[model samples]
Target: MAPKPKKKSSKFSGGKGRLSRESKPVKWIESMAVDMIVTLKKISSEYYHELPNRPDAHEARLFYKNIPTRRNRYGDIPCLDKTRVALIDARDGNDYIHANWVTMPNARCRYIMTQAPLPETTADFWSMVWQENVSLIVCLTKIFEQGKMKTLEYWPTSCGKQFHQKHGHVHIRNVGVRNEPHFALTLLEAVNEKSMERRKIQHYLYLDWPDHRVPICTHNFLQVVRYVDEEIANYKGKEPMTIVVHCSAGVGRSGTLVALQSLVGSVNEGQVPQVCQVVSMVRKQRAMAVQGPEQYLFLYWALTVHITSCCQIPLEAKKDLLKRLVLMKNCSTKSACSLSPITTDQPDAATSSARQARNEDGGDRKRRPSNVKRKTPRGSVTVRKSKP
Candidate 1:
């Protein structure tokens, strides 16, 4: 044997010994990050561009026939008739609301995606909530954003106050409230004046989300999803409770939240998360879901962060990947890239410490003030009458 060919070193082996998978973990994380970035770019540029626009006649006939006053907050957004949520008991016999039922394949729960209740459509909004037996409302937009009224103050602002929608025959009482730094949880009791029936509802108001952009903190966003899931798990209703999710126009932020929640659930169940497919499915149910390339990219970034933090990945590898992810998210666009020393709101203590270390290394030192407000005390219920 010609001096016996030197034994080839195994890629899986380290110097003089077999290496555990954890060895050189950054390499593995790097590969994963690269794959995610590539997938996001391909989907954003190709598949997202090719999505068919909903036709006017068949898909959105009612949307067009509805009076201009009742049309969507954004004039161009279409609500597909096939999946539109009709007001079953509209006193005026006009059953249109800019809302749709978004059901994901193999999902246990369904979502009612709707625009934030317009001042004119508040009664219709309450009608749908009562008819659909919706117990959880996830509000993604603030009442006002950039000096424009994004959503009407549909719910009672203080504890013990009731918002009575006489036209819809619904009375919603603010029973309790728990305010957090990023969101507020209000316990509401919805009563049907017609049937004298009462149902408990939870309203989650996410205040940090910007009007047209994704939330800067993925961890906080996920916390909202977790809270929603917990409420769903604890539900004791006889029928399946549909979740009501809304932003201003009920497409971008709402869609992102739905997609994120679905993917997170999929991952927790040991299934592979398909971001592009999930988003496409959501858009089919609700037109223009995940509105921009930034929001689309955010789904990938958020899912990656979830995996690195929650899964059984090596700790060192997870840290490395997260740092790289922050860079990727911050530099996803030319405008985003111009900002120096990007900081992300990470969940775990390790990640938080790492962020602190990075901040010490010449990052922006100014901290954002917490948006949490004191919760109003529960007191005597007072109903406010509004003109129909």
Candidate 2:
């Protein structure tokens, strides 16, 4: 009998049959979508619960002991000493403010995450901005939300109006204001009175994000992120500028925005979007980033929209996957909507190893809420509390 002939294997086959070149991309996208869905489930059920808590040793000693009057907006949310940005020429040698330097992959000291300035700290806030040469400021909260002061008015409200901080001799004048759909843009000129040096600053206030809850629409938030990037690229500063991002406590909303930006940068660089890893990295620098499960899931959904658009996935497929993910958000329990595992290509070994290492280090730890309410001062009315 003649020997049986061997069949040639196809590059686009998984031992089932050969796929056309066009079908290959479709299969790859489908596989990626499935992996993302699984990752989302893990985030909701396992990974989130296992995130590391803020180390106890990184206490804000300056805020508590030396400068007790610095007045942390949130008592529990400490500004770790390792990452805190100190003012170079602070008056009376008190250089502490509730801000931390947050770094992203391939970008060093890219963002200064900060709390909204109180009446007393406003001058120090402007001083930090001037010293850092910040060209862009992303404000995630309004001055008042739910009739409570979420953040103090840190900039001049009207064009030509000036806010002068005598401590650093920093003067900020509002040059222009423009309103958009979900955000407002204000152009401000910061002048150092001593040296007569001036710097143009763009302040972007996002108005739609509710306290403690994710934005209603992912597209709106994504647009805000892209707009900020566009403004950064247009900057003509003498050196690369660090972006200042703040909300009430500077952890929840600020962290979410930074995390999304980091993930978008990673995707743009042709790397897979690792939601858990990105959040972990941010929290290591600034604690309690991506505050709750909802915010964490929002990151994944936003990335889904971004990745599908970038890869040009079929509209119908994208719609179906997004619809399912959205439904998962409303489920009462994490596993209420069961997603069956798909037999497809696995992610590269490097990604798998990184995830495994993160899990091991996490070790069933739970994130602690840092926004605890402090006692109201004498003769002051009690304000309703909300998340930042």
**Top candidate, metric TM-score:** 1
State the C-alpha lDDT per candidate: 0.65, 0.63
Off by over 4 Å in 2: 1-40, 161-168, 328-388
Candidate 2 global lDDT: 0.63
> Counting only residues 3 or more apart in sequence or on different chains, how many pairs clash (N, Cα, C under 3 Å) in candidate 1?
0
lDDT per residue for candidate 1 within 96-152, as digits (tens), equals: 889998886544456899998876888889988888878778999889899999998
List of clashing residue pairs for candidate 1? none
Task: Residues 1-388, candidate 2: write the lDDT tens digits.
Answer: 1111222222222111222324433343345456655755676764447675665743657656544685588877777777888888786777788888887753422688998999888888988888887877899998998999999887875553334334348888654455555666665667899899977676778887877777655656766666554444433445554789998989888999999887766655455667788888888778777777888777766665555544444556556765555553453223222232122234222222222422443521111111211234652222223323
In terms of lDDT, which candidate is strongest? 1
Cα-based RMSD of candidate 2: 16.9
